[model samples]
Target chain A: MSSGETLPAAQAGTVESMDCLVTIAASSGGRRIEISGSGAARFRSAMENKIIQVLDSLGGPGDLSVTVQDNGALDIVLGARVEAAYLRFREAMLR
Target chain B: MRRTMLYLPGNNPNMLLRGHLFGSDGLIFDLEDAVSRSEKDSSRILVREVLRHSGFDGREVTVRINGLDTEYWRDDLAAVVPCRIHGIRVPKVDTPQTIRDLDDALSALESRASVPIGATKVFCLLETALGVWNAYDIATASPRVTAIIPGGEDLAADLRTSRSKEGTELEWIRRMMIVAARAAGVDALDTVFPSVTDEEGLRREALFTKQLGFDGKSVIHPAQIPIIHEIYDPTEAEVEKARKIVAAAREAAARGLGAVSVDGRMVDLPVVRRAEFTLERAGAMTEGGAR
Candidate 1:
């Protein structure tokens, strides 16, 4: 099984806010990111920054686009969504 | 109020006539993209005549009109804007300016036909890449704009991505569009789940979108209506939980308490708001009972 095949339970305190819809779009070659919503703009930006940091650490040569619909979700939950999307994309590429 | 807005070709009388029984909350008499160029006039006349006589039992009736950039738009507005439809859906909206133009044209048509100024609201379809980028502006362009729906087929084409069964690629756009709608304080609708034969896929996607916080979904077939509603409607467990939360909150308030505890968890203002939304959803699903 590929590393991205598993659905990890959301970790406690992973998301700092629960008022945003987190969407991560990542391909095998590059990534594009967008944060949207009127409330919790700062949190969304911070989450996007962390996601980019993580993706840069992974050193995966692919395009990734992350869009956050901020509804005040916790930071951990936002991280989990980004990880889940990256894993899902990795799994699809493996397939 | 529309849970499932079914699209029917403007020229198809049989579909239009049987629309009420489809179990959709609204019917969109499609004259823009679904009908051919040559049949535009005839389709408008047919839809108008049908609207004049058809008794849809107060189902929200919407007419999708061609963009103002097209030659047929003026005639479409002149013909259908005066009809007793609930709203006019404009296709391929790229900017707030375009929507303003549509509003102007609608006003002219409404006045020319002696209709009320605000009788018909506008529903904007963000089809192209540029349209999606400007979805928020288009949604908030006018007070008459009630809903913003993404056209997945056109969007996919615009993005030059193949439509996948999982729809992962469209996820960002869908979420962004919903955020835009909510920011604008209007309804955000999901595009139709094609593949009428894949009912399971349809249900799964509907549930996913509902979880993503869309107000409703666009459906192509009658069979998809119930599935969409079922996904959208609050579950029994959720309703029960909502009832408990509301009851606890009410009791706490009566006792001069600022908060309530339910299931050993403290419930605050946000929790109450969620419970209220849950109850409202349950009420909408049921006829009169709290269940």
Candidate 2:
């Protein structure tokens, strides 16, 4: 079931204090999320859940690889960054 | 007392992202007047996303929505009131019904969002002569109102005058607003001085605002924060007097006296409360109310 469509790869936000830089790339699994860096474990589930929620809101949950460079971003910051990256990927894929 | 409130453009993600860096007592994310018509949708979405995501780090967070006549205000309210917003400022408010309507709208939004009733506050931006005349009614119209900001530029236009260097044109409205705010038990905030580079002028104007009983002054720039905070902070002598009044009042209460004498003047509940508030604002008071 391949229509030769692939979501674009893009990143949004920075790994600054109280912020999270989200980089999303097209992939095979429904979702592949990895967190690497300090202070990621405790918030790993929360961040992943938020990313899924944002993608769902954007008509997503598509196959994707999400790399979150965490810097203590709140849920809303994470959501916005994820949403921005998702839109960017979606727009690029259409073009 | 709110010493300084910095307004950041709501549409710009960078500014919205960085609003909490400055040490302001309040942060206003402005959607009206700051955002152009074309960018309203994007800005509205961005502000909502930011609000949905960011914690304001103890600073009071407010969003200034477009006027009721605009097509975007309802959307703006739907986006922000559900978030962690402390207050919503409806700009160019000319009638008490404006406040009443906003209150009802906010209540509906709160119910829709499942947030507690009356959790969100509102600030009336008295930007026109009609708004100024109805300031008292607008301030007291809703229990959610916590502050009234006397608008400078729009208000000047409404008054059919231009802003003067000494602010003579806006003085009377400022006076009236302070009375209205005090009578309504809400904070009266002064408008921003348009001249950002005029440090001396800003200081002078802030001093005038403080003397006129303004709780704080709104700023559109970060540089103006310290100048306004300095003027609003209680002076050293005033802090000392506050300490004395508080101590005397506490001792008198312990001695079963209804009123206390501070510096040979009889002090009562109101003065004691004022003294305690002064110390609190000065950041010198602890649980014991002493330096």
Candidate 3:
């Protein structure tokens, strides 16, 4: 699911795009996330690492897919967006 | 150098316990006016105990004692002056001689208690009409006097005027008190902003006081702390402008010039000094990360 996708469908998979993208999955399998951007590979790795940390802390058993839109955002900001998506997904799951 | 001194009633244990977090530069455990005659003794003892046990964490703590003319003055000083408080706030101070007399008594108490005279300072509350008129003399009465605060309610009572929310009646008094305090080279503090709900009014009054050269304003309620701090804190634009001005001045000085120009405005010595002070204050505020 991308940030544009309001509600996730019954299926879980990874989606990617240039503007904005998101990945969602159920917590049955181990979570894996990877991100790449235009700026630097180091930045992408940092963002991926932070999102994984947040997901691990949340302790949900789901196959995770993360999408990134490289609109010249810093690694911290990319990580923040992923964290926001995770929080929203968790909130929706709770509901 | 108390920039903001909050008045906490002596009998309110909740306020006493939370005094340190009020964001004021100092706290005055008020024993006079706030506490009734019947509760004075107990309140004094409680305040002393609070001072002894409560960890104020370097916040200046002063006890506002009952006036010397009152019978409770002796007992109040005997109970509190020996504690590790910062200063003694004498209310209803009307004359230089009155402050001198209080100073003498405080000196006696300090000597008898074996505490250093310099440790226990004095702050005068100019409450009466006569006190406001003689504020300058009272401010300079003794070396121990650190600040002169106006008591709006009593001063209005002495002047036979009704208290107004706008504080129009006390405008002249406030101006005179600031002038007197500046003339005496001591900190001038404004009276309490009575309305806790009227934060806009409080900010207006705090800015007025800051403009009039008052070091700080006294607050009656905890809710007024953020408004006062907001008024006193340098604005984002001010901080940025100050940084630019300071940088320009430093560059100009390095080039053997006495002045610099920033954004087509001349940055002279005084402007640079003001900018430096603003930066220093901003640095102090952000030392432990943004609050």
Candidate 4:
């Protein structure tokens, strides 16, 4: 079995206005997603659902940790950022 | 009547989502210079999603891809061409070969995506001295070339100079672009005037380019849109004169005459055609002109 420590982390997006910073890392257990920043107070659940939807579409989250630092990004932006970060993370893990 | 085409940062959600509402003639989502190197991949994804999900309010939407010299251009095209964009603005195009290469790439992408081949147009940005020299060749390079534009800062740098408020550096290049575009039967689009705050300067440059036979100008700021439109839109007096000339020409044509007289001046085929073009620019030909 592979350890999470052997994989590298990957990120996408920036914490700019109407944008978000999404980072994904290898996880040893079940999939986990965390949301924070200016949009988290009111949009944490919605953002989490978006992350889940994108990750699932990309062939499931697998064993990974997704963290989002949003700054008032729309749902579409959030989905794009999550997909980008997860793809990067997946590429890194494969490498 | 594309008097102004505004540039929207590809990576900025706020701009990408709302740029069409600013009342420009078209919108150009910029993925080349506006996006940083580190964010190229992410920006490409973001632009694709935005194009997929958001509507541009029916404005002509295009994207400026990275130059052919870069590794990211093919990826950029693969991302956006499938989105069914109207066209792509390719920068630093120096010869017809560049356009041939781009056309080939786009055809493969469009075919793969089930899009109609040749539906995706190309707008060439002639930024270097060689590019400007080969303007006609580049414009006629492919059937997909709808317009050719002169470069602003990039062209200036390539010419070993910097931009001036009076635009002394780009005058000859602009002239050549208009001539070449017209010779090639394509539209001549002027580059952006970077001094966004200089209203008077922008007006002067727009007027100059319009008089030089440019179809439109690339806009950097939304505020410049109204001014460029004002310059390109036909005035009331001009429209009225055009209508009178068109009416006279219709009567003459009905009588099988070779020439007509409008406002006590002799009008011919060319003059009537010019009047019809004026009516077209005023957006009144089909609505209020002689059939």
The estimated TM-scores of all candidates read 0.72, 0.78, 0.70, 0.94
Per residue, candidate 4 scores C-alpha lDDT tens digits across B214-239 of 99999989999889888888889999
Q: Per-residue alpha-carbon lDDT of model 3 for A3-92, expressed as tens digits?
A: 565544121111222122345544324665545556336566666666677567667446655555454543333443454466556656
Which docking class does model 1 fall in? incorrect
Interface RMSD of each: 23.0, 4.1, 25.4, 0.8
Best by DockQ: 4
Angstrom error at residue B164, model 2: 1.0
TM-score of chain B of each: 0.94, 0.95, 0.91, 0.96
Model 2 whole-model lDDT (C-alpha atoms) = 0.83
> Best candidate, lDDT-wise?
4
**Tens digit per residue, CA lDDT, model 2, B149-261:** 88888889888999999999988888999999999999998889999999999999999989998988889899998888778888899999999999998898889999978
DockQ of 1: 0.01
Give the distance in Å from residue B224's predicted Cα in candidate 4 to where it truly belongs: 1.2
Give the worst 10-residue stretch by lDDT in candidate 3 chain B: B282-291
User: Which scores greater on lDDT, model 1 or model 4?
Assistant: 4
- Over 4 Å off in model 1, which ranges? A1-95, B288-291
State the C-alpha lDDT per candidate: 0.76, 0.83, 0.74, 0.90
Off by over 4 Å in 4: A1-7, A38-43, B284-291
The alpha-carbon RMSD values of the candidates against the true structure, listed in the order shown, are 25.6, 5.7, 20.2, 3.0
Better of 2 and 3 by DockQ: 2
